[model samples]
Each structure stands twice: as structure tokens, then as C-alpha cells.
Target chain A: MIYLELFLNFIYVGITSFGGGYAALPIIQHTVTKSNEWLTSTEFTDIVTISQMTPGPIGINAATFVGVKTAGVLGGICATLGFVFPACIIVTILAVIYAKYKKSDVMSGMLRGLRPASVGLITSAALSIITVAFFGQELLELTFASVDLIAIVIAVIAFILMKKVKFLSSPIAIIALSGVVGGAAYLIQGALV
Target chain B: MKEKRNYKILLPLFWETFKLSAFTIGGGYVIVPLMKKKFVEKLGWISEEEMLDFVSMAQSCPGAMAVNASLFVGYKMAGFIGQAVSLIATVLPCLILLTAISFVYVAFASNTVVKAVLTGMSAGVAAVMADVVIGMIGKFIKNKDVISVIIAAAAFVCVAIFKVNIIYILAVACILGFIINSRKKGAGK
Candidate 1:
């Protein structure tokens, strides 16, 4: 029954959640933690971390991991399916419809509204994660010394460079360079601490 | 003669687009590098310059980067039908993966080590997301569209300060976009 419930939970999340993995986080947290009682806050937090490391999106990973926990391999499969099936089904239909109406005014109007909303949603999700992960209680107590300030600064600089320079669309370069800088900073911080 | 010649050329492009879409792991900017390697380097379906242009268009357009990319690549390959084929090919993998995975999720999801790794990776996940947004902002600045900049700022405020539901923000942005674009079109006439 728990396993079945978990499957349904993932299906509910997958179908309703419109944006990407990050956007679905709060919803997942609410369902897994608040409503279902399937996972403790700590457990859910760990699930989120593990989901991030896996190959697929967080929502998919969460469903897989959580489903497996409750029922075994079958459960993992169910949850993952429940999560991704919704998006897949929806996107496929949308793709067909969008293709058919590629030139129509209604399509254009809806997209025009959708694009900015996506940007805003993406931005808000980023901010929420930043607030929780970096700027929240523990970091505040440390007075930002142990904070990943270098990462933040590097990110801002990268944004500026990308904005000002037309030649920097190879985001791979920026991600790699930032990773190196961030990794080095963490090592230095660890040694100092 | 033209029909036979076009089919000869178009069929392979459909297969190629399918393969590209199948293996792309993460959505949005995560697949940018992979697409560059495949489309720009391996297949020579498009140039690096063209890929960058596609990225810009994909970002600005409404919908997933993956879908937008398919449209661009498919259109470039064989016009309209290519777009349909690519979109299907790109989307099919997710459907298959989801269908297969749904049956097995409940079992493997409960382990201790798995939980720990997932927790550790959350920080990394956040880092990656931050990286993408920052990179986009840098690119966006070049466009110098005051309206876009303002929209971004207002969106940040609406989300961060007001803590409004995302759907509401999306609705407002859509309405605003329609009005603004319509006004611009009217003025052009």
C-alpha cells in the first residue's frame, strides 16, 4: 500500500508540476514530508541530495529512490515512471500541437506569455535554493566567512562576461573554470578551518 | 526527381536527430555541450556559429531547451517534417525510460548510502543551477533589451519578495508579453 501510494504521489507531482526539477522541489518536499509522512525531513533532504547526483532530473531520481525504498526495484520503476510519464505524455502532445500551429497567432501569444514566466520561475527557484543552501541559518551564524562567496562572485562575473561578450556561449568553459575555482576554494577553506 | 532526391537526404537526418535526442541526460543548458559536440563537430549538421544562434533562439523561445533545439536542428535538416521527427525522437526516450522505471522504483529508493550521496549532491545541484542562470544573464546583457532586463528584475521581485505562486507570475508575464508585442506591432503599422 505504501508503495502504491508513493507511485501515485510521484504521478501527482509529475502531472501537476509544470517547470523543471528545481521547480518541483517544494512540491516534492510538501508531499513527501508534510502530507504522506513517507519520509522525515532529514530523510527527504538526503533523498534530494542523492537525486541531484544521479543522471536524470531530481524529480525522476527522487521517485526512483523513494519508490525503491518502499517496495524494491519494482517500486523504483513505478515512481520513476509516474514522475516522467506525465511530462513525456504532455510534452509529446504539446510537440505535435505546437508543430501544427507553429505559425498561428494563438501559439505565438501563449509562448510570449510563457517565456517570461519561465524566466521568472527559473530565477525564483534559483533564489530559493540559494537562500536555503547558502544564506540560511548556519551561514548567517558564521558571518559569511565559511560561505561559498567565491562561487557566488565567480558566478556573477561569469554572468557579466557572458552578457558583455558575444563569444562566451560555450558555457562548458565557464562551468569547468568555475568548478576548478570553487573546488580550490573549498580545499583552501577546509585547510584553514 | 526532386521528391526522390529529398527523401534520400532527409531520412538520415531524422535518424541522426533521433540519436542525439536519445542520450541527452539533463535538460536545458546541460545538453548544450553535448549538442555542440554532436551537431557542430560530429555530424556537421550545423556550424558552431549556427549552434550558438540556435542556443540564443532556444533560450528566448518558450518551451524546453531540448524541444526548441529539436525544432531548430530538425528545421535545418529537412524543413517541417524534420522538425516533427526530431521532436518525436527527442521525446521518445523519456517516455520509454519513464515507462520502464516506474515498476522498480519502490525497492531501491530506501538505502542508507544512496541517501547520503543524494544529500551531498544537493549542494552540487544547486551550484550547477546557479552556474546556468549566471551564464544566461551574461548572455542576456548583450541583447540590451531594457524590457527583458526589467522583466527579469520584476520577476525576481515577484518571486523572491512577494513569494507569489509561479503560475501567477507566468500568467502576468504572458499577458504583458501579448500586450507589449501587440502594441509594438500596431506602432509598426
Candidate 2:
């Protein structure tokens, strides 16, 4: 029954969480915490934090975290399977359709449209990430006081290196170096305090 | 036509996706640029333009961003099995890490050192994304289509300033492209 409920709830999340993982958090929170009571409000919030801490998509991370907590390892697999099922089916079908009709004028037009729109979408995402990183605030809520100069310096320097230096192109290198810098910042702050 | 399955290609695809799934932290948007680096830039499995097209299709659909992108990539490179392998590979890291953390979540969740590392990494993530935006927009600018440029600018404002739903903006932009391109008669992007 626990496995069934976990699969069903996450399947529901998969079917409806149309935009991306972040926008789906509230809906997931409602289903897991409010309706099933599988997790307390505090636990659900903690899962969100954990999602941030871990690698990969937040939606998959949350489903696995909840299912593993609720049932066990197999439960985690079940919940994850449920969550990814719809996307696989939907995207596969769409891909087939796209492949078939790709040469059509309408398809070509839509592709044209998507090009600029994706640029916009990615830009929006970039801005949001920049806001959270440099300012420690949401996109709409930035202020001069919330600014983190250390983070900004890291980002700018990384960007420059990524552009100029051949070896710095891989994101893994940048991410690892950023972590070390961040860890050092933490230690320095702790020592001063 | 059933695409012939090649274990040679399949193995590398699996390992690359698995490595990326494990290391790509931050969030959804970050993965695309990274994938561009891997698949388009390094592997030569896909072209630069083809990568963007797949990205648009992936982002347009509903699902985990990471999963959706992999689906397109797998489907292109290795067909249905590739899709399954990529999907499994993408989710495997999450399942493994989250389950492991579930046992000691209380400690893991409140660890300030982890927070600081992620904070610093977020800055790195931002720079990566900014580079992506600039790179993509640079390509768009090369086309020198005034209307397309306007569309890109307008879409940015709609999302960033007005806080509009991204789907709506995407819908309108797509339709505009359809109408305007078709009107030009024999024009194709």
C-alpha cells in the first residue's frame, strides 16, 4: 500500500508538473505532506533543502528521498519510475512526430519560434541563478545590502576563465574550484567570528 | 526503421550521461550548457545547431529538465534503448544519493559547509549560464533578423520583469514564428 501510494502520488506529479522541477515543488509538497501525511511539513521543507544540496533534478531527488524514507530502496525505485514514466512516453511520442513532420513549413516555423524563445527562457534562468548567487535573493527581491561580493567575484572570474582559458571550459572544473573557494570562505568566516 | 543497436556507441553514451548526472549540480538550466559542451562540443555526436533544437524541444515539453534533454539525446543517438539507458542513467544518481542521504538527512540537511560549497558553486553555475545566454544570443544576432531579435528581447523582459509564465511566452513566440515564416513564402530557418 505504501509503494502503491508513492507511485500513484508521484505519477500524479509527473502528469501535471508541466514547467520544471522548481515550479512543481508546491504541488509535490501538497501531495506528499498535506494529503498523504507521509512527511511532516518540516520534513517536506527539509527535503527541499536536501534537493538543493544534492546533484540532479529536484523532482527526482524528492521522489526518491520520500520513497526511500517511506518504504526502502525498492520504494525509491518505484517512485522514481513513476515520476519519469510520463515524460518518457510524452517526449518519445513528440519526438516521433517532430521527426516525421520536421520538414513541414509549420514545423519549421515552430522551430524558428522555439529558437528565440529558448534563448529567452535560458536567459531568464541565467538571471535567476545570478540573482540567487550574487545577491542571495530571489530575482524580484534583490537589494544592495544582500549582495555577496565574494560570490560575484567568483562568478566573474570563472566566466572570464571559461572564455579565455582552454582548460577551464569544463563546468566540472569550475564547479569544483568554486566549492573549494566557498569552503575556504566558510572557514575564514568561522575563524573571524 | 529500427535503428541498429551499437554497443560501442551505447557504452560511452551510458558512461557520459552517468558522469554528467552525478556531477551536474545547481539546477535545471545549468545542465543544457554542460550538455552542449559534452555532446556538441566534445563528442561530436550532434551539431551545434542540432543541440539547440533538441534543447528547445526538451524545454518545451513537460518533465524533469534533465530527463527531457537526455530523452532527446538518447533518441537521436541510439533509438529506444538509448532512451531507456539514458533515462535510467539520469535518475540513478538521484536515487543513490538521496537514499544514502535519507539515512542521515538531519545532519546532511543542516551542514553549513555543504551550504557554503553550494553557495560558491551557485556563483559558478551563474557564470556558466551567463556564458550560455551570451553564446546563444550571439548566434541569434548573427542571423540579424530584426523581428527575431525583438522576439528574443521581448521574451526576456516578459520572463524576467513581469514574472510571466514561461509556457505562455513560449506559445506566443512559436505562433509568431509560424505566422511570420510562412508569410515570407519559401523562407526557412
lDDT on C-alpha atoms for all candidate structures: 0.57, 0.83
Cα lDDT over the full model 1: 0.57
- Binned by DockQ into CAPRI classes (incorrect, acceptable, medium, high), candidate 2 is medium
Q: Count the backbone clashes (under 3 Å) in each candidate.
A: 40, 0
- Which candidate leads in lDDT? 2
> What lDDT does candidate 2 reach at residue B179?
89
Ten consecutive residues with minimal summed lDDT in candidate 1 chain B? B115-124
Error of 2 at B111 (Å): 1.6
Among residues 3 or more apart in sequence or in different chains, the pairs in candidate 2 whose N, CA or C atoms overlap within 3 Å are: none
User: Residue-wise lDDT of candidate 1 within B1-189, one digit each (tens)?
Assistant: 232225454667666655554434333444555465457755787875456445434443333455566667766666557665666665454444543443543444554444333333233334545655654555567867667667767877876777666556666776786687787778999
Error of 2 at B9 (Å): 1.2
Model 2 chain B: lowest-lDDT 10 consecutive positions: B180-189
